[model samples]
Target chain A: MSNRREIEREAEHVLRELSKHLEEIELEETYHVIDAESLRADSSPELRRGFREAALSIAPRRDGAHYVAEAGTWV
Target chain B: MSRQALGEAEENLARRFEEIERRDREINSFIELNPHAQEEARRAEKLGGRLAGMTVAVKSNINVRGLRATCASKTLENYVAPYDAVVVERLRREGAVILGMTNMDEFACGSSGESSYFGPTENPSAKGRIPGGSSSGSAAAVAAGFADAALGSDTGGSIRNPASHCGVVGVKPTYGLVPRHGLIDLAMSLDQIGPIARDVRTAALLLEVIAGSSREASMLDVEPQPYSQRLSADLSGIKVGFAKEYEEVTSPEILGVVKRALRRLEAQGAELVEVELPNLEKALPTYYLIVFVEFFSATRRYDGRRYGYRIEEVCGEEVLRRIMLGSYISQKEYAGRYYRRALQFRSLIRRELLQALEEVDVLAGPTTPKLPHRLGERLTPLEMYAYDLLTVPANLAGIPAGVVPAGRVNGIPVGLQVQAKPLQEQVMLNVMLAAEGRA
Candidate 1:
């Protein structure tokens, strides 16, 4: 666990060093925009049910109608 | 097909299954065996798809119905894929029988194949060494003859690095050239699912079968071409770029092997031009920034409710480190300085590679800077990230790049990487086909 802590700290140190070089690069917001055209195929209820069952079959805990998860701290 | 041919196909598959059962424990290449593989081989006789009787090993991160699509992490160790990935569906449509899922780095986070929860996958080429990863198991399985070909994803050097170490053929097709509908993304912008096989022609055939515009994914609009068709061994008219900067980061043994391969290409009448890709040094840090941020976003789905475990609790050191770094860089205060700058650097990298490609048909270099080391050998995260130095620029540029086994140094394999412009897999494959004969 201490090794994990060391690795995390090392990673943060490297990121800060990397950010220092960002001043050399020009500021640009022109990120590559992806084609948002949807090619999603509509699935039938049978397919939907199969996916639901597949997920539910392996859920750590589940009620009949829903997957049971640990209560959120925020909520 | 004749009955005799069908029988031969079945016999071949049976032998492969037997080999896996007998020797796979030592290599740890495969994670699961497709229960329906035998049935699929039988069905191949009646099918008319291009890959009618081929056996393909799929990376476990890509969904295969009825098999768990674990990213070699405990987080999804028991999560069964509800459906086939688009690539898998395409392969099945072409009548390729899926062998099973191969192992990988946890959440596709590591360069060496040692980070898997199932345990490290041993290199088939060098007995005690690691298999370069995150496509580690895919390359190993192909090298061990457990499958005719395998599918692997390259976010950076994942596919080609393993292919190089395993002494096999692997291609990382142009970003957005192959559909990523089912690939578990390490970095959404950089991830490309590609094919690995024993020979260039087989890899090209598998790529042909898998590459196209998908109904649910954005990909290149170009008509799929027969990449393996009429590939000429003669390199008379081809211009090959040799970047001098690659030698600075590459080990002497690997550089020797790659230089010799370049010489062979030169002998075949290829014009070797000295090219400069000055932005190459910046690719490593740039690649990591994008990957960490995107992977952090991708892994948010694994909150223990839908997957096998909460990633933060059960993931490996590499995965946890990336998540932490990603979370840090994504804060609004740091986003402009780190993530946005990385994107800008990525654009600069793309322009540099494209400009180089205009002068040459393809760029040639060592796939990885060094050979695989012994499993469990200690390497810092930056040292591990260095493995992708020679291979990441292609991913950043969104270009087609492939690895063909060039030669071996001291019983370990080195690969010659051939990179071409986006959607120019044909050029890449031809270079690979020529190198396959020489290598």
Candidate 2:
């Protein structure tokens, strides 16, 4: 099974590719972060860990689950 | 053109203003008609393109910055929004003037618009018939010609139901197509803002302007292929699938009209296929459980804290019913049994719709099974809730659906609902155009 990380990576990669097709389209912003603990808080730690693993596929982690990227990072 | 256009269109404003000013008295349509719409309509004439500076009425649940977003309930009766909802911001950014706010069921819990604190909005159809609620005023305003178009929130059957009863056109875009930021959500997973108008073209035009990705509504990250395009090809070979079980409980007059519509489509070159969905049996019970739990949870912020009046003190029957139901469903061990079952049922419905659309192009049915009910007849709550049976499945499926005036029965209008697969709005809309004689 391609885990959830693989899925997010694939989605972000396809979006970045699609943005190049048109001029003046609103590809000016793209923000993808997968933080299960801050968003859910009380859920299972394992589930949070799973989402943390998924985050690795989308963006490089800074500290813990927080990740940030500039708008229009889809290039 | 800009401000100069308002100067030019000044002559056209007097007549539209007088008509809205006259009819809104009886219908309870506008919470507040913008004092500036007439003044702005003059500027609108300078404006060009799709909307042409047309004015639009917004639902009370959506924000317009400093305007009140009471949601027709006492709890938020005094509330003023601090920011525009993404849709409202887009409308202004695109030059479609915001006319004013319209009334709705408190927290969008009712089917008859009777739960609004502003009082039950009179249906513009039969004097005694319900305008079919939650989006009641929004529908009544469009039918009475108060504005060119209005924005309404549909959770369950809110938008399509009223459109059916009031004899207008309304479209709920595919979920996440329109943004949710600053919408006082009735149910987060199901509520969507869409255009209600006199024709499908206007609905499509508004959808085109609003159907794009937004940063605030993170789920709305991908822009849809522009929704306004009308397929030039004939609908002759398109397949329409309908559940035969839908025929079991609907009224004869309403069913007769919907059947006639299907027959008309058949004569026009489209092929009709009979489809069966067995899981449909659990849709109703499941719908309430989810709505009740979510509604119950969403109201926690209204404890006389930030917004309007305290809920129980001023809320009407429908609002009270939901709060009470939400409390009961969320109590003790009943939480998972009631709420989770509903979510599971929602997933099942989504699966069935996706599976059915695999072979058929669209699903065809009466937007509502029953014609508008009499205004004062006493009925059980469940009887009223049953009106949503045909419509909620489409919302749960996260697909685009619309109701156009199919025909009249017993002097009230009936709607033909057409639904397409997730994100396949242009396809379904083409089919609706064919049924509405636009083809």
Candidate 3:
């Protein structure tokens, strides 16, 4: 737990220094967001099948056609 | 070239494979050798493209079909890539034989190569010293002649850092200039997959092949240029910029070596101009803030559900540190204080670099602030992060940067970094060619 705290402290120090520098610079609030839309072409049937097989090849848990994933918990 | 010449080239490649098997036991540069490399070389000889008969090493973070994309971590120890990365696909089409996947700093987290789970890569050039990371093996492989060239991705100096330490040329193309479709990236916005090779022309040729528009990659609108044919040693009218901030951070020994290289460029008729970047100190902190957030987000995919082990459970200390810090910084309450501000600083630094480049063609500096430490030497995370001080601004600004062997400091090779404006790889490669001539 102490080790975790030390790491947190180190992160805090870095962030605090950055915060100070940010305050010194006077710039308008600007948002630079890259559009998240996928520009990739639709995969051909063969390509899609290859991708599915490849994905299944590495999956730790999978049924015949479905990949098994851990349930997200809100707690 | 005749059939006999082609046969000789195949024979040379066969000998290189033998050399890798023999020499890489100590260097640990390759994570795995391609079983089909000889057959691939033979196929390349018959097909004959731009890079025909040239063998290449791939950094483990980039996908090469059927090879383990481990990122030097235990988590992905068995995750074989499903398909070749766009770059690898391009290399295959251009007739370059894939040598194999090489080692790296786990999750591309460390500047020194020591953090790899497979064991640290030794500096083949410096002997017993560290090979800089996280593209450690790629550069070392080229340096030790394991491959004619190699592919390495630079987020914050990963490619050039190792290239500098290993005495080879490494390039980080403009962020959007090279596609990142299949890279397991550290920070997506900053990552650019580039070439590491024995000389400038080979690096330029590799860059020309792999850099172009791809629907798989977003924001990559820059058309690929014929970089190799444009190379010239005559720098009669080229303007090179030097920054005091870079010198202030660099050790005197490394700086002196860099200064001598600058003088050589001057003798070749290149003009050196002094430029100022007042917010240079802020770049390191800004770079880390963004990397932490992005890396944390990227690692969320490794939950042991679909592929690989849950990263947090099996990653190295540096990887976990970035993950934890990234998680903390991405919190809604703290995001504005850290991550968002870092983005604004990124813009500011980009503007500063573009402004500086207006007066000068390229900026030259020492690739690393200090020489690489000895292998297994313990350093605090901050100390390790400082190694990227001289190289991160280029990434932050999304510019093309390349490192050429400058000279030596205490028998350890130093690199002179040349950074050009975004999509100005030809200009950057030309300066690198001049430095290579001096070297």
Candidate 4:
């Protein structure tokens, strides 16, 4: 688990580096919290897409009055 | 003598107390076992009700009024619940004495229950093995006999995994069947408060107290069932579907045990059939992506604000990871990409489950693929995500699921999962009780 180091070059974005060091697929890996200021001035559509996908998965979807979200999988 | 049943129960409680004192030191199954449980037991006996003298341990996530709901995380440390969680309030209404709040993975994140700031909970069934978690303490509390039953939350497999590994009964009620108002949210859409007990009948009793509508908080958005109190044991002609997707994901040993249990159900008169839940294979990644994003949003309130703890400062490893992922995913730019795709997949899975249920009354399988791991055994987030293979469908479909002790594999107990359609707990429990040979 690489702790965020804000040294000569500060970085933003949760370092996807934790994705390395290969562990068992069912195991829990460390959550990365980056400095708020480190966020990229601009994000790629790919990054945006991943986050959007994740968000819609948990976000409540409402249609007028009824909560129409029967889509996301339960954890 | 009905009143005196309390006295006898107190005596039983005393004996159990001595045992908990002796065994608890080794298992650490309890975060807090009320020192006055016996007195409360006697009082409950005098109250004279269905659960009058029964002892219940609440998961740290469920509020017990004066007791703290830490969600087993340091984030909520020192935060005693100002009011009772809906289930706790219901338990109190029924004359049930809460033993104490049990430990869990912080913020209900880990499957191993190792992410607690207090300490890792040990598996009660097989020594040196992890009590499957998120609901580690809740299941272990019952497995260790520290409490008669326990209320636990299952976002994914928290209750079922621990119950499976600990040789106990754990059930995740259909979402909305039980209110969530007082319970802390991990992922509001997915988090469900449930019961962990030694047997299915007792679990039903606890569910009775906790399930239903409150004036303000209806755990289920709609009343799925009027009462989950009286689950029938009759599965004579019920149809049980075995999901084809589970074959590639389940362990042979686990499946072998589950198959025997299914055969037992068949012998008891259930019709076994093969069913398809095509999207279930994608449910793990889909569930994780959703949990990460939502959990992050839920924790945002804890940024050293009105909430008790700053997660970045005090939350455990799994939680922080999720917060980051959740926060990342919820950002404006990424709104529809990853989160939407997962949601799309989520919809597909739910559609598949509903279609499968149309053909069968319930589904059955091994709750978890692998057996328990030792404390500190490193596993990747994806691997950790795999444990919910069998459980995600229930959550995704917002249905009730029961995990009973099927038997053991290499000394570790395995859970046989029985799931049913939304709000159909009786049908689910009937299938499960028959399957577990509880009749």
Candidate 2, position B204, lDDT: 81
lDDT of 2 by residue, B1-439 (tens): 3554545444444655687778878888777666676655655565554565676889899998777888987777778788989888777656566778898887788788777888778888768788987898899888888777899999888999999899888898889888888888888888888889888777887887877788888675666565566643357789998888778867888888888888888877889999887666456666666776688788887776555456766666656666666776578425344565556567777888889888799988888878777876665566777888888887888888998888888789888888898788788777777777431
User: lDDT of model 4 at residue B165?
Assistant: 88
lDDT of 2 by residue, A1-75 (tens): 224344344433322332222222222232457877657445545345577667756785354566655444565
- Model 3 residue runs over 4 Å out of place are A1-23, A31-75, B1-4, B332-335
Q: For each candidate, what's the DockQ?
A: 0.28, 0.02, 0.23, 0.02
Regions of candidate 1 where Cα sits further than 4 Å from its true position: A20-75, B1-4, B332-335
DockQ category of candidate 4: incorrect
Model 3, residue B140: C-alpha shift (Å): 0.5
Question: Regarding TM-score, does 2 or 3 come out ahead?
Answer: 3
Which of candidates 1 and 2 reaches a greater lDDT? 1
Model 1 chain B worst lDDT window (10 residues): B1-10
- TM-score to native of every candidate shown: 0.89, 0.82, 0.89, 0.83
Candidate 3 overall lDDT versus native: 0.89
Give residue B308's lDDT in candidate 3 (0 to 100): 66
> Clashes in each model (backbone N, CA, C under 3 Å)?
0, 9, 0, 38
Point to the candidate with the largest lDDT.
Answer: 3
Q: Summarize candidate 3's per-residue lDDT along B118-146 as a digit string, tens digits.
A: 99998999998999999999999999998
The whole-model C-alpha lDDT of candidate 2 against the native structure comes to 0.76
